[model samples]
Target chain A: MKNQAYRMALLYDFYGEMLTDRQKEFYDLYYNEDLSLTEIAENYHMSRQGVRDAIVRAEAVLTELEDKTGLIRRFQERQKELRQLQELASAAQAANADPVVGDYLRRIQGLCEQLKQE
Target chain B: MKNQAYRMALLYDFYGEMLTDRQKEFYDLYYNEDLSLTEIAENYHMSRQGVRDAIVRAEAVLTELEDKTGLIRRFQERQKELRQLQELASAAQAANADPVVGDYLRRIQGLCEQLKQE
Candidate 1:
């Protein structure tokens, strides 16, 4: 549940460019910069309700893009799958596999790390 | 170069639902059904140019979606990386890794195959 915010942040990363300038600013302030609605309103010389509405609109756009493309869902799925692959590779390497086989398994683990980061 | 058509098909898989029904029909006819513009036009009682235009518009929509989200490109990258992982795992198993390690390596290869299919 705590990662829900992280997912929203990732959605913004994928689709924030499509949002209007004002929405983008307010969303970054509230979500990334961790500013309260009142703080964003004061800084932007807008009402708190306006800031809230803009962020909500940005969220809607991001969610809609994700729904249409399912990119974020696929990304998370890949990450989960990669983690499983990494675990298996690590287990194999720890089992005293042959030196050559260990080297290959190590390479596999490295790729899983890199792919997960991507 | 030949895979260019395959890439477009993958893009359509991700974004074709966003296209209009007509565009989707023409695109499917031209690409998936391997129908020529003339054949699709004859079947739909439209001009060849109309069928071509619809397919192009559908292509533009799919291309835009991919450009905005980079989902298809990312998917391709992951598939390529997983293929590499599969190769590594196969090499490890073939190198006479410990039987237990071989089992794990086999599972990793299986996951790579499954993920690439996804």
Candidate 2:
């Protein structure tokens, strides 16, 4: 459930602008602010069911956008690859004593850091 | 002009599905298929100005999305970084005689190649 919530938050980050204003507000309150449906409904002067429906619609829209674009998936894959590359570089750096090889490994690690920090 | 067209094509690749069907068709015909505004207008029974307008609208929509997301810019930067990483790995591989250092460099090069192919 936690993983799924995090994933939905990321989807919102990428495609939330496409949501309707009410939907965006409800979804953000529920997901990011951890608001209860009753609380959100009271705040907006809406029924709990109405708030639930809007949040669900917003989720569907965000997810459909992600399905079409695959941008988030690609971003995650690249991040994983960078992590793996960094680990391998660190291992190689530790094993090698040659200053020349050390220099190259250092440069490679720098590149990996830059990629990951993005 | 050629570089700009290529960049527009890439923007289309990222966000074309969001455009209206007619906008997508006209943009692809003009940019991807190299059709002139006149040719596209004739094929679709649209005025030359109409075809031009649709293409321009599509371009504006794609640009707006890019401005909001910056995904293309990040992709280009990562690709450039990968190329540099590949070159450094290759140089290290060539300069080192240790099979172990060469092995690490070879693995690093493999990772770079995988990333570039994506």
Candidate that scores best on DockQ: 1
The ten-residue window of minimal lDDT in model 2 chain B covers B1-10
User: Mind giving the per-residue lDDT tens digits that candidate 2 earns over B37-98?
Assistant: 99988998889999888888888988887887787898889899999998878877766777
lDDT scores in order: 0.80, 0.83
Q: Candidate 2 lDDT, tens digit per residue, A55-89?
A: 77788887887887788998889889888888888
Return model 1's CA RMSD, one decimal: 3.2
Which stretch of 10 consecutive residues in model 1 chain A shows the poorest summed lDDT?
A1-10
Model 2 bad stretches (over 4 Å): A1-3, A20-22, B1-3
User: Cα RMSD (Å) per model?
Assistant: 3.2, 2.5
Q: Candidate 2, overall lDDT?
A: 0.83
Give per-residue CA lDDT, model 1, range B6-56, as digits (tens). 877888888777788888887777778888899989998999888777877
Q: State each candidate's clash count.
A: 0, 0
The TM-scores of all predictions, comma-separated, are: 0.83, 0.87
